[model samples]
Target: LPTSSSSEDFHESSSSESSDGTSGTPTLEPVPSPVPEPLCWEM
Candidate 1:
């Protein structure tokens, strides 16, 4: 299903972004976004 594919894509994107964020950016960008995740129901 496309929704599954999109979820996979989103996960990959998150992994990539997290890796980049580890380089120097605020780790908070990833680690503390629990509140925003459910709020964004878009694909």
Candidate 2:
């Protein structure tokens, strides 16, 4: 479950204040993400 910590960190960063959470959803599959921004967030 520790691997999920990486996803948690994304939520803590720019998306922490993200109200809709819709934007954050794509982070779940950042492996095939089209946007560099979301890919960056995944890391």
Which candidate number would show the highest lDDT if scored against the true structure? 2
Residue-level error in angstroms, candidate 1, position 3 = 1.0
Give the TM-scores of the predictions, in the order they appear.
0.36, 0.27
| Pairs in clash, predicted candidate 1 | none
lDDT of 1 by residue, 1-43 (tens): 9999999998777567767646434654655575578567653
- Backbone clash total for model 2 is 0
> RMSD in Å for candidate 1, one decimal?
8.2
Candidate 1 ranges beyond 4 A from true positions: 17-30, 33-43
lDDT of each: 0.67, 0.67
lDDT of 2 by residue, 1-43 (tens): 7779988887677567554667666654563556777768899
RMSD to truth, every model: 8.2, 8.6
